[model samples]
Target: MNGSSALTLAGVLVLLTVVAVVIRPRGASTVDFYLAGQRVGVATNAWAICGDYFSAASFLGVAAAVYATGLDGAWYAVGFAAGFVPVLLFVAAPLRRFGEFSIPDFLGRRLGSEKVRLVAVGVVQVVILSYLVPQAVGSGITWELLVGSGLLGLSPYATGILVSTAVVAGLVAFGGMRGTTWTQAVQFLLLLGALVWLAATVVGEGFHYGDAVADLSRAPLENPAPDGGLTSEQNALHPEEPAIFGQPGARYGGLGQFALIVTLALGTAGLPHVMNRYFTSPTGAAARTTTVWVLCLAGIFYSLAVMLGTAAREIVPTAVDDHPWLADLTVDGVLQVPEHALPVLGRIYGGDAGLGVVAAGALIAVMSTIAGLLLAAAASWGHDVYERHINPRATQRQAVLAGRVTTLVTACAAAGLGLALRPETFATATASIVATMVTWAFAIAGSALTPVFLLTIWWRRTTAAAAVAGMATGMLVAVAMFTAGLFAAGGLLREALVTPTLVAAPLAAAVTVLVSLRTTAPADVEKSWLIMHGTAADRHAERLAQLVLDENRRRRAGRRARRARG
Candidate 1:
């Protein structure tokens, strides 16, 4: 590694360590450890959620997709940003109002069924693992590109996976949700700052966005082929046509595009890590406000990402003559690993320092996301499973220990999977495999958990039996369709299978409705409804807080009067 680049990365890691240590949770209370005492502010939680949500996929893969596929790639950003709308309107407030450590905990208590809670735990783990592995893979990719060196006799990619997972796991295990939230918020600022700096640099260099798109569209799109050369790609939407960079069919057909959007848009509500952030809000209203802030922030971040991707596509080719090192990373002006688009652009503009900034941002993206996922996993396994089921009378200290252990184990598993599914294995298949991998998680979440989760909150008649049925059906259907998609040749069928949320979510909801009609609702359905939708608890909490503040003020005034008399 270059000394400057190494120093930049080490500096970022050290800063995160300091933050985690400084604000680390002190109590043995699981509430403090897992949910940060449910006192996080709207804007801070919004930033932390963005940090958790905008993983390597958002940081690296979105730009990679845009760089490789052009217009279709932009849809990823649009879909991701739009996904929060449903959450804001339907899920956010009620979810926070319900107030639980995890999705499984909420479902179990809401439905009054241990079976529902246990089953939900299984599904949550699946979603978390699905999300976690891609983050690990992203870390590996970033390390390979940024450092270009191995550690402990491993490949740079594998070393990246292990090191990142280990560090983030340690942070979550010790720091808990409070520390993770603070660090995530900071990490997101770094990510946004890096993007802004890169965008400004590119724009300053006399690059016009419209002219670049028009120029790129004038020629056929080509990418690095697996066989070490460039190849012209045909449009998947219209098989007879050559793909154009500015058009819609570079990577996905019309149906594929719609499927991708639907999957991501619906999936946001069901992501355990993201959903868990809602629980950290002090009130349901704060949760809703956080969603609004998240939407606005996401729009800005993604718009810049799309622009930077375009800049990379337009600028990288011209720089190859002057920067010979880039030639090895690219083939005939196109990146072999599409995820390298941003970092490569950074190098071209600011040399090693620019690349360091961008690379550090990528790693930050991976680690922050990993921290969220690990915490989610801990909540599910430790609080939901171990505390509730395995050891019902477990002490607060025991529960916290359980969570830490779960975090470490889950992180290790994700790292191992990342190494197995290394990027080079399918280097030429898609421009940004990380984004596609994340979409699979979206499909699973949208199909399984989201359908049942929404029905539980809105439909008073939604029974525990129906929830189990809906969740089981959604998970199985999504997994089966994705498995079939792996072998199918390209077309609408493949698109539907791979991005199965459009089919699976509706089917899951339908099953839930049908099953609920035949089953008895929970006996406390009305009570649960009041808890979920009523504002009484929020009002009470506000009054209690005001009383405490007034009391403190009176005590201060009395002390001042006594001092004046003396």
Candidate 2:
């Protein structure tokens, strides 16, 4: 990308941050900062969820996975999209109805124990930090490639980390959820539009999708290996045979595929940033309906992602032929940096200008996700730790101040870790470094939080002590297993450790049940059940959602009409 384009993108991001801060509600209360005042319409919230959910992992990693592993890579997108299904079925309405400011708040109130709340706060922080590091990594990667220079004498990577971190932290800390929500919704549209345009450009120009899939399937999936050579690749997918792109065992063998999918599917509900989004909905039913819209948007977005991945695989050699500068980066017609599959594809097709557009999308993906995660972190600290523990007598302004400070701190910490760690890619993951870390976060959340979260809502007998035990068990086991897995010799055991949801989640549920059976149930079991699953409550929520969706549609149509007349 040229300096002019780079500066333009920087200006755009700065303008967005300014707009977010400016639009924040004046004299914003704690509610506005933490939960967007609980008045977000269904459509708007759904868009924001899409923005929040599709981070660097979905934007760059999914395509890179396909670029690296063919059909096996498609599972990342599939698993991500599938996760919302469980959210709709088990978590959304009930959790929203419970109406706590944060996950710790809900668990603490429901189980009637400060212990439960504090324990959950630990798990939530782990999840938030795990998720935050990758966004920082993605930002640094984008800046290094797109801008290609350090800013203000910092290393390119550090500059990228600090610049994106500071901007997003400011947006969330100052603007809060109300500001972040609108900004996120707009960012999602920008990301979706960029991907759609890239897909259209590639497929429209005489690229036969069917033929590409057929060819990629017949060729064995291979990745570059370091053997002191320019081009030496080992089979990373389906090593025994030349794998088909659309078939199974192409990327993951044994039970690794199933474990990865289960982790992703269950993890969505456990994600603090994601679940917190439901709390922004105007009502329980609106939250539920917003989930439905999330599913629809996810499906559309992932399908396009799948196409882009396939297109990149088929286009790489041609791209190299068009741009000889990639000779050093592309070995045997495959990009060594799998994460570059999308932006490099853009660089191949449209020169520097094309690269700027796609790279901008990647940067936007990173920052938007950072904004959501920081807000969730703020809620975790400001609401769960500060208001509930440190300063029970604090006023609304004080709470917002706490949240804002926490946001800035979290951003700085995450950025520091991102630069310091710079985790190398795992051999068997067949995903980007950013994406692999995200999977670990998902596994931890799904294992540690989802099981307890669901049982707390669906099972009346769930006790505070049991919920606490289950979460602690899940957190320790998942973290221990993943850390061990990182150093273990590769095989089924390594895969299991890498994606521990299958084992961790069930163990947590079992512990919860056994403890609950031994202990007394939550005192408000009957009332909690009524709040979680009452028929009248569902009806009331659905009616309110219909009104919001109807109004949103009318306003959207009015804007379209006004644009057409102009």
Candidate 3:
């Protein structure tokens, strides 16, 4: 990249840092650090949720998947975005009304069981770590591809991982949730803008997305199927297939795979980082509004991404030897490094400067996501572990310090994992692995915690023992499935065992309900339901809004009075 381009990228990062520092919450209190004092507005919270939800997976991974696999790659986008719809309808509002600092905290209070809280903390930590490692790997990979040189004798991959991780850790440590929220919201908008701009430029080049797709479809798919149909592999590996559709694989399949889609779509409500965002909103109404905005924005972003992927398919010939830069990167012209396709496309259209902007956007996406995950990790550890178990008498400042320390430790661990597991390339492989690891976490949360949470707020017969039993069974089943998948050889057995949530979640819920039926409901169940479902929090949020307005009016009146006196 040119020095001017490098400078532009550096300037953007510095500006973001400064803005975050300026808005950093002004207290060391756990509430302020963890939840931004619960004062974020709906629109801002929505953007931050986007930032948190759309990680390296959404930015580089989804685009790369589309670039490599064609229409098959679009499945990732569909699965990811569709997951949010369930979250908005079934999870968001009540989660916000629960008003807990973290998922574990919410479960602990509602179920009235510290054991359940600990179990939740353990599950959440595992999910966060699983999700964090891939993001670090992505940053390293992008850095190596974007800038040929590594900083300070470090490999470009290592440098990328270190720098990006450190920057995010510092952001979280200094700004806490308040600063992180504003920065994330802005960052997501920039990401969306980058996507929109790229899409417009690609279209302006006289490339019609629909036309391109039709052309691609007319070509023979490369891979041979069980029934002699084409597969993605055939299309990607064999260039002999007509260049229109590029390659052919399963465009659509039986209901079994459809079940996987259903699992993912319903699973979004269970993700830790996503659920954590709901608590940051001031009220249930704000949370609902935020989800609505997220749905619209996410839908737009994913649609454009799918279109861009199609354009790349049409514009960039499959033969790597045909392109100058691509020849150097991929031996066979098929993108071995799936992440490189989007950046390469950026350069092809906008030259070196455009590549720099796109590369920088990828970095920002990783950084924003890492910051959110680290904070979530810190909250789970510090609040759920140190304060709740180790030192019930710990002060708020002490708890905040613990959380910050945990954030640093978690970041380091993720960086180390990324370095050690330097995979040859990241494609759907990385994404699938990350998704699989968290799938169980979501299942457990949805089946066990979510049920208890809902029932506590709606039904009057949810007991503490039942919640504990439900969470334990959910955790056990999720772990068993994960272990079986990891240890078992590839085949139908593995696929069935690997996605345990499809089995475990329902069983967990069943156990919880069955157990609860035999026990007496907690006396506080009705009162808790009133708090969780009633509009007290919404009313409080409205009152807070009025106070802000009134304060602004008084300030204006005081200024006028001063002017008259003068």
Residues 173-227 of candidate 3 have per-residue lDDT tens digits of 7778888888898788877777787888888888887788778777543322333
Residue-by-residue lDDT tens digits, candidate 1, 1-566: 44466547646754764475466555579998999999999988999999999999999989999998999899899889999999999999999988999999999999999999999999999999999998999988888888888898999999899988998999899889998998899889888988999999999999889999999999999887777788888898889999999999887888889999999999999999999999999988899999999999999999999999999999989999998998788888778888999988888888888888898889989999999999999999999999988999999999999999999999988988888997877676666889989988999999999999999999999999999999999999999999899788878888888889989999999999999999999998876787788788665775687799999999999999999999
Q: Scored by CA lDDT, what does every candidate get?
A: 0.90, 0.83, 0.72
For model 1, the superposed segments whose C-alpha errors exceed 4 Å read 1-3, 6-10, 537-566
Candidate 2, position 351, lDDT: 68
Q: Candidate 2 on 344-440: residue-level lDDT in tens?
A: 8777766676677788888888988999999889998999989989999999989899999999999988988898855334533445777778888
TM-score of each: 0.94, 0.91, 0.84
List residue ranges in candidate 2 displaced over 4 A.
Answer: 1-3, 6-10, 17-21, 24-27, 228-239, 242-246, 423-429, 537-566
The candidate with the higher lDDT, 2 or 3, is: 2
Error of 3 at 466 (Å): 3.2
